[model samples]
Target chain A: MSTAVLGAMYEGIKHIFKHTFTMKYPYQKVLLPKGFRGRHLLYMDKCTGCGICAWICPERCISMVPVTDNKEYPQNPEKRFPQYWYARCCFCHFCTEYCPTGALDYTPDYELAEYDRELLLWSPERLSRPPTNIGEYQSVFHGKDGNQGVTFEPVIKQKSK
Target chain B: MTTEPPSPGISISKTAEPSTLDVSVGPQHPGSGHCRILIRVDGDYIVSADPDIGYVHRGCEKIAEYRNYVSNIPHLERPNIADAIHLNWGYVLPIEELQGVVVPPRGKYISTIAAEMNRIMSHLYGLAIMQGVFSGHTTIFMWAFGDRDLFIELAEMLTGARLTYSFLVPGGPRRDLPFGFEDRLSRLLDYFEKRLVEYDRIFFSNPSVIARAKGIGVLKREDAKKLGVVGPVLRASGVKYDVRKVEPYGAYADLEFDIPTFEEGDSYSRYLIRFEEMKQSVRIIRQALEKIPKGPIARKAPLVAPEGEATGRVESSRGEITYLVMGDNSDKPSRVKIMNGSFRNLIALPFLVRNVHVADMPIIYGSLDYWPVEADR
Candidate 1:
C-alpha cells in the first residue's frame, strides 16, 4: 500500500518529466514543414484564367471573374484576376497545380488569421498576380515604369504568409 | 414568469428476481460524431445495452449519387475530416484502377505516405479520447490535438492545403514532395517518436488508467471473431487480419511493418496495440519517404469517366472505409456507398456492455471507438 502511494508519486514526477513536448504555437511561431501547401499564387501574365483551375478546385475556392465590379479592386481595366474565396477553400491546392500556365504555385506560409468574415474573402486584386519573391523582385524599393525606387524601409512586420 | 413543470417519479423496483434500470449516454458525445448507448442495469451490473446510432444522418450516400464524380471528391471528406487524405485516396483508387491510368512509382509512394501520416493523426486522437473517457486525463487529449497540429502543418506543406485536401486524383497523387521534404519529414518523425515514450509513461503505465481499463472489457479470442470487430481492436484480440495486409494497396506491399497482436483482448490491450501500431506506421512512413522514387504525382488523362461500377477500400482512422462508385459516362456518379468500420464494429457493443456498471459504460463505449457518421452514411 505504501509502495502504491510512493509509486504513484514517483510516477507523477516521471510523467511530468516525460511529457516535455509542449508546443507554444501562437506565441512562438511553429516551423512550417517543407511542402506545406498554403494559398495560391498566380502569375497573371502566365495564367490565361482558363477555367481549368476553376474546374479542378474540389472545394470550389477558385472562381474566374471579370475584372470590372469585382470584390477586391477594379485595378487594370483591361484584364481580370482570379477571385479567391478562402472561406470555401479546403486547401486542396488543385487550382495552383492545374493551371495550364505554370502561372500558379504554392507557398509554405499558412498563418492565415482574419477577423471579419468579409476580410477572409480575397478579391482578384488581392490574389490574381503571382507572388514574385522579394529576392526576385529586382529592387522592390523602386517604383514601376522608370520611377524613383519604390523607397521603403521594412516598416511593419511584413508577414507575406 | 412561467413556472417549470415538476419532476416525474423515478424509481428502480426490485422484484424477487432481477430488474433493469436504464442509463443513456449521449447524442452529444465529445467524440467526433453523435452516438449514444442505452444501458439497462441490475444491481451495479448491466442487464442489457443498446448501441444507439444515427445522430449524423447527412445521407452522404444519397448525396453522392446526385453529385458528379468530380464534385464527389470533396463531398466524401466530411465523414471524418481528421483523416481526409485516407478518404480522398480510398475514393480515388476504384476510379484509378478502373481507368487503368498509368501511375508512376513515386505517385503511388506519395499516396501511401499521405495515407499513413493521416492514420497516425487519427489514432493519436482516438487514443486521447480513450484516455479522456476511460480515465479522465484531459492533458493527454489536449496533447494529442496539439501534436496533431504539427502533422497538419506537414500535411499543408505537401498538398498546398490543410484539412480537406483533394491531393489524391483518379490517376495519382496531386502534388510531388516539395523541395527539402525528406529532411523535414525525417525531423518530424524524430519528434513524433520522442513523444511516444512520454505517452507511454503518462498514459499506458499510469495506475489510474490501468485500474480503470487493464483487465476490463475483455474479449476472448473466440468472442472477438463472433463479434466481428475489425482493425486494432480485432488485432488486439489475436486476429491477424488487416486490410492493408490482406489487400495490398499502393506501397503497403512494398513497405515492411509487423502487425502487432495481443491475446489479452482487454481495453488495455487495445490501447497498447494501437500505440505499437502507431510506431510501426511511423517506421513505414519513414521508409516510404526515404525511398520514394522520383516521378510525377499525377497522370494526364482526358476528362470524365466511362460507365462502370468500382469499389475501393482503405483503413480509415476509425476503421476500414470502403467507397463504391458507379460511373455513368458523365461527370457525376450513379451512386456512391461508403462502408465505414465504425458503422460495422458498433453492432457488437450491446453484447460487450452487458453486466458492466453504468460508470464503466463510457470507458467501454469509448474504447471500441465507433464514429456515428460511419454508420449514418
Candidate 2:
C-alpha cells in the first residue's frame, strides 16, 4: 500500500522537469492543419452566380446577393455572389464543397469574434481578402527520454485554395 | 402580509419522510451536464434517487424532419459531441440503406479508423472528466485531457474540424488519410501506450481510487441483463454483448479485436472496462491502417431516399445508438427516432444510486459515464 502511494507520488514528481503542454492563447497560437474548416474565401473570377451554395447550406446562412462592384467578370454575367452571415453558419463547409465553379474555398481564419451582431455578416468583398492572423507555430514532439513535449517550429504559409 | 395557498394543480407538500431530507443534486452542471437527481437521504445514506432529466432537450428528432438527409449529419451529431462520428455514422447508415448505397471497401476501412480514433477520444474525455475529476485526482484529469488533444489534432488533420467533424457522409468518410498519417498515428499510439502504463500506476492501481470504487456499486450479471444496459456498462457486468460484434458494421468484420469485459460490475470495473477498450481501440486502428485497401473511398449516393423505414445501430462510446429513419421518397425524412445509450442507461442511475452514501453518489454517477445532454436529446 505504501509502495503504491509512493509510486503515484513518484510519477507526479517526475513531471516537474517536463515541458508544459498548453499554449498561451491570444499571444501564442498553434498553427492549424491543411484543409481546416475555418472561414470562406470566395474567388470572384470563378463564380458563375449559381445558388448551389445557398441551396445546399444546412443553416441557410449563405445568400447570393448582387455585387455592385465596378470590376466586370466574364464568368459571372449576373454579378451575383454569396454573402455569409457568420452567426448562422455552422462552418460545415457544405457550401464550399457544393459550389460547382470551385468559387468558394476554405481559409484558416477562425478568429471571427465581433462586438456587434450586425458586423458578424461578411460581404463578398470582405470574404475575398486573405486572412491576416495566421499563426507561425507548429506543434512538434521531442523523441528523447519518453518525455512528451511540444516544440514550436516556423510554419510555411500555404494558400488555402 | 398574507401567505398565499399552494396553486390548485401544484403540490408544495414535502415528499420525503420525517427523518429523511430531500436533496436536489443539480439542474445545473453537476460534474457532467445539466441533470438533477432528487435523492431522499436519511443521515449520510441515500434511500432513493429519482433522476430529473430533459434540461438540455433540443427536439433533435422533430428538427430532423425539417432538414434533408445530408444536413441531418451535423444536427444529429450534436447530441454527443465527444462521440460525434458514431452518432453521425448511426444516422447515415439508415439513410444509406434507404438509398441503397454501399460504401466501398476502402471507405469502410477509413470510416472504421475514424470511428476507432473517435472512440479513443470519447473514452479519454470520460476518463478525464468523469472518473479522474470525480475521484479528485487532478493529475490524471490533466494527463488524459492533454493526451486527448494529440488525438484531436490528428482528427483535425483527417477531418477538417476538430470535434464536431461531419466527416462521415452517407456513403463513406469525407477525406482520405492524409500524407504521413500512418507513421504519425503509429508514433502517437506508441507514446499513448507508455502513458497508459503511467495512468494505471497513478490512477487505476492507486489505493485511494481503488478503495473508493471497488465494491461501491455492484450490479450482478443477471441484474445487468435484466436492466438491458448497453456498451461498457453492460460489458463491465460480464455481458459479452457489443453492437460491433453482434451486428458487424464498417470494417469490424474484417478486423480482429476483443470486447473487453469484467466480472465485477462495480465502479472500478466500469473504469477499467473503458481502459481496456482503449487498448482494444488502439489494436483495431493499427490493424485497420495496415490492412486498408486502395480503392475509391465513396460512391456517389443519391440525394433522395425511397419510401421506406430503416433502422441502423452503431456501438457508440457510451452504448448502442439506434436511429430509426422513415423516408417518403423525398430529400427529407418523414420521421426520425433516436434511441441512444445514455437514455437507456439512465434507468441504471436511479437503480444504483440507492442505498449508497451521499458522497459515493458522484463516483457511481461518474462510473456510468452518463452524458446529460445526450440523454436529454
TM-score of the second chain in each model? 0.91, 0.96
Query: Residues A102-151, candidate 2, lDDT per residue (tens digit)?
Result: 99898889999999999999999999998999876766677652446555
Instruction: Report the lDDT tens digits of candidate 1 across residue range B1-377.
Output: 89945323212222323366566666665644376666667889887776656667787778776655656777787777767887887788887766677678888998898888888887887877754644688867866775676677677778755577777777787678877667767777776787776677667777777888877788888988887777777888898988888898888889998888999988788778878988998999989977788756778754567789889988776667788888878777787777777776786677777777777766777777766665776
- The Cα error of candidate 1 at residue A104, in Å, is 4.8
Quote the positional error of residue A103 for candidate 1 in Å.
Answer: 5.1
- Please write out the lDDT profile of model 2 over residues B1-377, one tens digit for every residue: 99956434222125657988887787765476588777888899998888877778999999999988888888889999999999999999998999999999999999999999999999999999999999888999999998899899899989989899999898888899999889989888888888999999999999999999999988889998999899999999999999999999999999999999999999999999999999999999999999999999999999999999999999999999999999999999999999999988878988898899998998999999999889878
Which pairs clash (backbone N, Cα, C closer than 3 Å) in model 2? none
Best by lDDT: 2
Candidate 1 local Cα displacement, residue B4, angstroms: 24
Candidate 1 regions exceeding 4 Å error are A1-28, A31-49, A59-64, A69-86, A102-122, A128-161, B1-19, B29-33
Q: Give the distance in Å from residue B123's predicted Cα in candidate 2 to where it truly belongs.
A: 0.6
Model 2 global lDDT (CA atoms, 0 to 1): 0.90
